[model samples]
Target: MTINLTEYGLKQTIQKTITATEQPRLGRVIEQHRELYQLITATGQRQAQVTGKLAHQATSATAFPAVGDWVLFSAGDDYTTLIDRILPRQSVLARGAVNQHDGQIIATNIDTIFICMSLNADFNVRRVERYLTIAWDSGAMPVLVLTKADVCTDRADKLRALADVTVGVPTVMCSAETGEGLEDLQPYLTAGQTVAFVGSSGVGKSTLINRLLGATVLATKTIRQDDDKGRHTTTSRQLLPLPSGACVIDTPGMRELQIFVGDLQQTFAEITALAADCKFNDCTHTSEPGCAVQAAVADGRVSLERLQSYQKLQREMSYQGLNSRQLEQAKIQRMFGGKQAMKRVKQRYHRD
Candidate 1:
């Protein structure tokens, strides 16, 4: 069967980036195992690596090709390929680590981000808020996938709890075993769209993806009935083409999501709207008089706990000792420029 690049998310916007001079081969990176990249071209799956110049020019790991990235490559001996450059990504999903300073690029050019959470022992509305914050900033739509719906006894209560925090975000409940509510996921899985499954461990990310794939392409580990801390079977990120013509990027479960940047405006829409009525434009919503957010909290319009959670996330965005502004500037440099921009910053600072 011939693989159609358009159906694999090679949209016209990305196709316009190709130049007649350098691009001899075009393919999407399906998986990156260390330095070797696995790409699916018009022919089939092929192994590839970045050119020495490309590798040398990269300033950080995120500058390299990630899964779901379209790349220009050249054919080599023994059927191997050498990647020349990565196309501009429409959307990027990344996370930060405590010990690690740079943000890790998990996937790129995705259409939707499925934030999975099991209803049984893994449900946390706070975590859902955190995920929504990160998702709203990703330039992709975020959908909350509530897994393990079959065994949940307090579905209504839990959903009611989540209603306030997940405002405007789509939520779906499905059971991988019973197949209930599985059809709800089909709308987002249409052709040419690439959706990613992401959540903490044992929330049934792989299981739900397997159900969507119509086969167990990924391994699943049974969750312990006690605390839903089961390990994920998929150890790395991989982009798989679904039979329906859409692509699915399966990622390893992230228990503690360290956010590099977030869009709290969408996640805390109610508070953001309330802040408009505040007497001060820069109201922190703490104890200031005429603070609209605090006033809303007093009248129960917004929960104090949720307000505090939002503030905590605001303070927590200082990833790896860099202020949020620094991290954002770093991201801008990674996305649009390279060593030249970094050098310019240093030169401007040194001149001052």
Candidate 2:
């Protein structure tokens, strides 16, 4: 029953200086299935649900108890616990369609995100770029893990295809079945670290995680030859402890999300940097005479595909044709790119 919360990434700062709360229990959410939650507390794993008050006050799905979220709860009965508060998250992965105000939270407080895509037909560099945008924006380090190494031919060409979008990102190629090249993932799974694996359905996220866990805790379906995508096997988000003393949160097959403006800027940092050198501040990279991004594309510094991907994301999020309210949101993201940046802004405001 008794478990070490520290082993599950209970931050030292929260354990030390946080003031007392009305809630008597502290727990980490390890699994969630729609309305139901399974948590790890000092006593044991408890089935929990959020109080109506908590749900009422929650402005968005991002505020709810997601896998990897820490919550304060109290026993509602022998069978259930009532979650009162979801602790502040250091990092969060959220997704939604274009123009959505309250995007869905995928996971929270994660240290790293393993964006998996099969090296076979399921691999798409643009999709990787989209995942990278969300991962970079989530305040977690993004690592590209290419699964199904055994099935891949023309590996060099595939790797080359990924080069532009995956610049400065850690990438490892391995076959989940053969266990080849998984060793490269060990350095990220050190004690106390929490990594989240995310990709579309049947990209071998479960297979890869099962191999890492040394057991088949999660079910994996064979990849469909017709679509070349994995079957939708993982339905709920669950955090499992790795044998290496780290934890990993595996999510279900994900849909492509509308890009976050801040994430887009980070994901295409090279293009953003190039844009800064443009003679005209508002130069669109398309056919603009003074656009440095286009110049880079022309001169081989930036791949045209990467630029097109960036532009497409911009269009998806309405950044290119932003209205007044959307423009304000863009400004906010530029000012507060992440939580750390937001904190700095607040500190400066107080000082002023």
- Candidate 2 lDDT, 1-352, residue by residue in tens: 6788777877753443234553248889999988989998877798889998989966555566888887788767565689987765667787664456656678888999999998877888889988888788777899999989999988899998887788889999999989899999999999889999999888899989999999999998997778787778998899988888899999989755566433777788889988999988888888778888888888999888888988888776534567668755544443233355456545654554
Q: Write down the TM-score of every candidate.
A: 0.89, 0.87
| Candidate 2, lDDT over the whole model | 0.80
Give the distance in Å from residue 310's predicted Cα in candidate 2 to where it truly belongs: 0.4
Which number leads on TM-score? 1
Top candidate (lDDT): 1
> Positional deviation of 75 in candidate 1, in angstroms?
3.9
- Model 1 residue 222 lDDT? 94
Q: How many backbone overlaps does candidate 1 show?
A: 0
Off by over 4 Å in 1: 20-24, 76-80, 319-352
Worst 10 residues of 2 by lDDT: 15-24
Which regions in candidate 2 have their CA more than 4 angstroms from the true location?
A: 20-24, 77-79, 97-100, 260-262, 318-352
- Per-residue lDDT of 301 in model 1: 88
